[model samples]
Target: MIIIHSLRFLIGLALLLVLTLPLQAQEARVTTARVEERVIVETIALNGSVTAPRTAQLSSDVEGRITELPMSLGDRVQAGDRLLSIDAEDVALQVRSADADVGEARAALENARRRLREGNRLGEGRNIASSELSQRETDVAIAEAALERRRAARDRLEVRLERHHLRAPFGGRLTHHDVAIGEWATPGTPLLTLIDLEHLTLEFAVPLDLHHRLDQAELEVRLPAGIDDWLPARPIADVPLEDGASRQFLLRAMLDDPPTMLPGMAVQGRLLLRNGSGPAVPRDALIRRPDGSISVWLAREEDGEWRATERRVTPGASHAGRVAIQQGIEADDRVVLRGNERLEEGQRLILDDE
Candidate 1:
């Protein structure tokens, strides 16, 4: 009976090893990546609308009812393009009155000279008194002063009437329309918003920790895709003041181009840094757990089989698709570049493309 019991126990142990062998030898399905060292950082993508390089709200310098609108909104206007015209009836009447006054003054001055000429001909012995001649001269001077005052007033009104004929400040397209043909556009009323689309700009931000990186390289900004090709870009002058919450700096870059650009366009660009060679991996290579922690899988060679080990990583500056690993991984450690989710510790993998 003892020999039979020992034989059954031995058979049961052999069967257990058969089942465990297949389980231990199972291949791990995973994606592999070459190890590279690169300067990396996580970044915050900022979204903003495009804005005109210069926005001018057209308004009337003199109060008047608009008799005509020569250009409508969205119309391209050149410098000195007439936009609006005010009623010139009152101003024209004033100018005529001023001209009449000048004529009357001229007549009075001529009459005064005639009196003086007659008196001079009579000489000191004549009945004409010197005081009387002086009185006539004074009357002529007074008439001249009155006429000059009227002329000055007329000229001042003429300027206001000229202002009623609005013109474009620069050659550009009109973006807004706040007035109509017969609208009573009073002084300080906005007539339209003009934009010069030739010059474009992009406003973005850089983190405080990574702010020093931008200063290290001659970075060039570019408009993403739709705007235009061959658009030139420039860096910002000063970093924005720190936000107490995020501790970041905002930057505004203007794109100088040949003709001009429109406002509110999508833009994507890279900010070159002084960083040397470093690992640039797909931003998704790192696993972000529900605990709000970031990590990367380090593939270790154990017993001639690839093993994936999770390591916590601190990420730094990021732009486009790649992220920078700040800590937890080394220059030559194999990382599961793609399909790392199915990996388990001590699992075996056959590098598909290897």
Candidate 2:
């Protein structure tokens, strides 16, 4: 009976010792950082194409056989440089004929004026009859009208002669030419294509919602096909019309110091939108759930222990490696940066030393 009592006493002592032992701590080792309010500049990426500011397909104004083509394809020309010359031989001959006619008319006019003066002098002394003087005056008037007609004809021929040579209207590179020496060039026929390469314009399209942000932002352009660096750009204008199908608007800008960028080259543009100050956290702290929601594991002090609490957050633009938290998180909040994927709600946390 004494042995049985001693066994019961030993069992009771063991139970008391187990009940008095402290529970194992449920703690997770994690890296943490304090959320900070920073001035975040968001960027919108857009694809576009590079284009020449001025492009033209030059055509002949007069019909003639091509006599001389001084500027060939891919030739650089300054403004007023002669690109093509049609056969001006016939036109030149016509101008000369007109000039001779003008000279003849002037000589005849002078002879008529001399006769009129002589007749007037004779009439003053009654040596010439009134009818004779009237006839001389009419001859002078006819000669004056003939002279005017000849002068007008000569001017017209000279103007036609000027059209035989096709001159460059602006300084540009000749990109195309179809007319060759001895080829017949008809009026309105395309002769060459000119493009001004000094000034280049980048054409892009963006959504309407970002119009306000783009207006106040700085823009940079990357020509994916030609240039390797991002070039600074200045906004020129936006087309007042919107694309009905895409629901987007067209924008144009001039690239500063562009390098060998040609028309129709594909480009990517970055618009930096300054969105003031906001609470930002490391991108590693963000957790994307299966429900298509984004949340973060925040370290909160609960019952004298730091615990991980999952909070749904509204994320804004991201810059560098950090994300802007627009809502559900505040500045100075401790967020789990590492080991967040294994974190559970209300799980005890042991923050790593910085």
Candidate 3:
């Protein structure tokens, strides 16, 4: 009876070991990376839009019927290029009449001067009276004043004639044009909209708290729909005043040789803050738990087998898929980069490379 009972106990122990060995020796396939000491520049994500330095709604300064529309919608124009021409026949006729009056005035002034010279010679010979010479001098003064008045009138008429043609104020592209030949254009009426695409900028509404950090931060921007590569940018100026509705402030930056971009296009920005350096690992190594605590799985070698160890870490700045470890991990420590999602403490790891 004793032998049978002992044999039964040994068999039960063997069965229990068989059941647990498979579970204990199970290995999790994973990939690993070593922590590196790098210059980690922290950054804040920003939402912004592309904008041009100059956008204008051009209009005619004078009222007239449009006789010539040199530029149409989507046309590029240079500074001083004629955009529209008005009917200037009436104004040109008035200028011509003024020019004739100026010529007549000059002739009258020359005649008056000749009479005054003769009068002075006659008075020196005592042949003309003093009162007569005084009258001659007064006539010359009146004639000279008449010439100046006529010239002033001609200059005014010439300016009016020039205003009949509207020229571009700056180099840009016409975005809006609705006027046609024989259409009546009046002052203060928008004829076309012009936008300068060469000098493009970016405008962002940033939180007020980050205003102080802008002085030392470098900016990088990318157009979400157009360019995927990040481009460097420099801060132009800030409004300094806050927007009451959004609780944010306006910040503008100039792009460095940006690709083709249009105003109002959405752009993403990263304001890089170069504060310090620390040990970092690929972003995939991070594991966020349900309790709002962040941790990482570190692979440690023990007894010639690689095992996973749960480590709580304080993460700082991140850039380019790598995150700086503020606390808990050391440089050169092996971190499980891939296949760490379901890892358990002290679980054996089967490295993919092996």
* Number of the predicted model whose TM-score against the real structure is largest: 3
- TM match of model 2 to true structure: 0.68
What digit string (tens of lDDT, one per residue) describes model 1 on residues 1-354? 999999999999999999899776656666767656665433334443356657789888877778988888799988899878877788878778777877877787777778777777765676787788787778768767776876787788778668879888888889888777677878787888888766555766556776666666443444555544434457655456756587877666765552334577655545556445566556667888899998888778888776778888887666556776667776777777776776666667766546
Which residue ranges in model 2 land beyond 4 Å of their true spot?
Answer: 1-32, 40-42, 95-156, 212-214, 226-229, 242-245, 274-276, 298-310, 336-353
| lDDT (10s digit) by residue, model 2, range 1-354 | 999999999999999877765332357899999999998779789899988879998888899888998887899999999999988998899999999999999999999999999999998899999999999999999999999999999999999998999999999999988778999898877889999988889988877777767767888888765457777899898874544777678789996676777788888998878889999998999999999999999999888888899999999999768899889999999999998887778888888944
lDDT (CA) per prediction: 0.70, 0.88, 0.90
Candidate 3, residue 206: the lDDT equals 83
Least well predicted 10-residue stretch by lDDT in candidate 3: 239-248
Error of 2 at 332 (Å): 2.2
Output candidate 2 Cα RMSD.
9.3
Per-residue error (Å), model 2, residue 183: 2.2
Question: Candidate 3 — which pairs collide?
Answer: none
- Across 1-354, the per-residue lDDT of candidate 3 in tens digits comes to 999999999999999999998876678899998899998788888999988789989788789899998888899999899999989999999999999999999999999999999999998899999999999999999999999999999999999999998888889999988889989999999988889888988988888888888888888988876467989998889885544777778889997777888888998988888877789999999999999999999999999999999999999999989999999999999999888989989999988855
Candidate order by decreasing TM-score: 3, 2, 1
Angstrom error of the Cα, residue 67, model 3: value is 1.8
